[model samples]
Target: MNSAPTNYKAARRDPHAVGTDSGKSTRGEVSLSSPDAMACLRRIAWLLFFTALTALGGVRPNSLQPPQQLIASYNDEQSATLRWEAVPGARLYRFQISEQRDFTTIRTDALLLPSKSWIRATIAGLEPGKMYWWRVQAIGNSGESAWSLPVRLSTNGEMVGVPVERLPADRSVLAFCSVLRFSWRACDGATSYRLQLSPSPTFDRQVIERESVEPYAEVVELVGGRGYYWRVQARRGSESGQWSPVQQFTLLSLANIADAAPSVKESQRLRLLKSDDPVPVELVPNPVADVLTVRTPPLHEGGSITLFDVVGRQMLRMPVAGVEQAQIPVGQLPAGSYTIVITTSQYQWVGTVEVLR
Candidate 1:
């Protein structure tokens, strides 16, 4: 009795194209040449189609399946890795890890990994003797899913092999418009460095690996809106030293690039420490542009002082042993915040230092 709705889809016309309702035949017939003029009739046809299909029942939602078989890895010095069995129909996964059982002391942020096959995330800069925890969740076009049961991780063993520093200074987000330059500190007694990058922190998917002896490398093809984990190891003759810490960084698109320099958001969580642990030694010239002097207590006098860019890229390493206080040259360093981890036989402490040019 009435004209058809103007919402029906046409094979060629835009979905929202409007249709006229002024034409009608005495026999109650309608002629709709345009797509939108046949919405009601198309709906009736779809109803009949889906109705028949509905009689056959339906499939389960994709979000119902969760990632399983979660595993932790400690393959490199100062690093932790989480791997899990991929969930079917999952387009992305969220991986989180923390030192606290309550999830209040997380070190890494939610890592959104694309691909149903992505199943791992590796993080570096883990101090020895600390208990860590981690979990994962799957995401799809449907929605985010329930988080998996958390798991605890125990330290494997004391770090060994000559330590090389990873760069882009960990967690360094780059603009997609710029070429990504990966660098690390050169290791003594090493002939080359192996650089590895991946969409999944575990290097399970979309992996890129390269080898160089210059202590630095570059890449030109990482897309925006995804997290990447990278690491480096020094190779000498038949021996490869322990890998530098794993670093996670994001590449952003052009819209986010307001200025010539890419926008960088540095995330350095509060220094993780036990309640009764000794506070780290004081460092003079914290907002220091040049030289930095560390006043160490007797307990940490002989410990090593190491500085890392956020996301765990080591920037500087020096022995603070046999001295009341240690001073290191930072005259040529760029302006930014850095983390300092002081390690001795007894305990380890972390703090932050800022550099200004």
Candidate 2:
């Protein structure tokens, strides 16, 4: 039969001592129910619980909250920038972009540390017009927390080229408007446009900079009777064009749509190509400061050459008798975007021209 040991006063009273006789006067005798032994058992059980938690799926300090208000914007059609709120005490962050919500086809997995000032990442080589989803996870010594809520972003699909007709035609006087919506024609396979709104004519100091997949953008928060300038440029994948000429419009209490529309009717304008495939007349000195030359034509009917503002206002018109094409003077025309309409009695050929001074 096992004999019960006698308790040592110093050792049994100590709850934290490692050795049963660790106290100043404690000896080797210690009872099984001593406080020191009980404390040791409790410490072992706590350690076991902690080890099990780390090995299992229970990460410490609770699951990380979903990325705060994830925002996605595109500087180029093939690339995007993502921004999120930084998580406190997160030593590591993992961001993933995928074509599918389930992340079956992952495009990018960006790793970031908590010390970063901005919790953002720029991902490139993405397809335009495709739908993508992104999520973020916070990781620390304790383990990884739950993934953030997925954010959906639809990439821009814009046309490439210079802007065409605008809501407020060049040199337009507004009747009334609090918000301005600028519209332009779309080019084929274009992915996006860069826009600038400025208070100055030269756009030296722009008030707004925007990138949009659509051909239109609406700007708000403007004071009445204030004149503003705006311009846009478009780009495709791996290619881009120059910025368009600036157009100015003044604000007022009047908001008549007709006041902003071009003087000429859009639907009434006739546009005919050489053979319907390849363009016929290619305007020479495209950014014509003085005379614009119209070359290339099988004009059979002594066509007349006419230049119209972007809004469709016929700016210059000259009758051509025997020549297939001719040089037209536009020195008197204001600096803005224009269209060259070369109409022969047979077919009306349409082309684009710009006046830069």
Candidate 3:
């Protein structure tokens, strides 16, 4: 160690001091006060300031890329596995599934960590046999990325359920018409439905057979004054459900209905031949005690009148036949406001009636 190390610390403290043994002035040597050194220090200070700003949320990276290749890897009756390709620089992922195409009603929304390139999530408690749409997005320090394109999936399985009839009640008489519409309640796990109409209750003589993805179907060119039978069956993949209970309906013709009603006046029957006019109906005795007289325009095709209580319970239904005036017995009904519905093959009218004491 000899005469001790040169005092570099003293030289640094004294800016004008000469470098020991080097025989150079300190100004020429690299030091904290030098131009180059000051420039480097300034750069370091700016970097530290920016780092602090980033920590305080003043700066962030660019938006992440959206996830892609979304698919339903596995699906069953009540659960499904959703998978997608990972996005670069994504710190987290967001996945969503909905029964609606617009995603208005979300079924599942989850946040997942981005630990692998292939991201997968298993969602349970899904409705069986229903269709669903799913999408994904990536989230990083910058912000969330745009939503990926939606993918469609169905949970149709091995088992299918029977469909229950909804409209055109069994054993009911329908007005004479060329077309009839039939509807049924939705069935679980059904991808398609089959409808069969027959002249016989046994369905041995099929008049029309239709396959549809919807729950309702329209059959045209039906014959009047005849009875028909209809049934529905649900199918999912290769599985077929049992046929629904057979239902029957009768289409009543004008002559058949006229034979069942009281005779109408000749003047009223002449109205049926006149040019089109707004259907006019009259109720006699604003509040009747024994019977209510309903005078209607001539019904050449016949019609029916249905009475309902305030709670929507059916009280009576009578055929209008070809008569312009018919009597309804309301003495036995309760003294409350009632609803009268007049139904014809082509038109229907609704009005209110007050039954007073």
Best-performing candidate as measured by lDDT: 3
- Cα lDDT of candidate 1 equals 0.57
Q: How well does candidate 1 score on lDDT at residue 300?
A: 46
lDDT scores of the candidates, listed in order? 0.57, 0.60, 0.63
The alpha-carbon deviation from the true structure for residue 271 of candidate 3, after best TM-score superposition, in angstroms, is 28
For residue 215, what is the lDDT in candidate 3?
A: 80
Residue 8 of model 3 has an lDDT of: 15
TM-score of each: 0.30, 0.33, 0.37
Per-residue lDDT for 81 in model 3? 60
Regions of model 2 farther than 4 Å from truth? 1-62, 69-82, 105-110, 115-117, 122-132, 140-145, 151-195, 198-226, 231-357
Higher lDDT: candidate 1 or 3? Answer: 3
**For each predicted model, how many residue pairs clash, with residues at least 3 apart or on different chains?**
2, 8, 0
Please estimate how well model 3 matches the true structure, expressed as its whole-model Cα lDDT: 0.63
Q: What lDDT does candidate 1 reach at residue 118?
A: 34
Q: Which 10 consecutive residues of model 3 have the lowest summed lDDT? A: 6-15
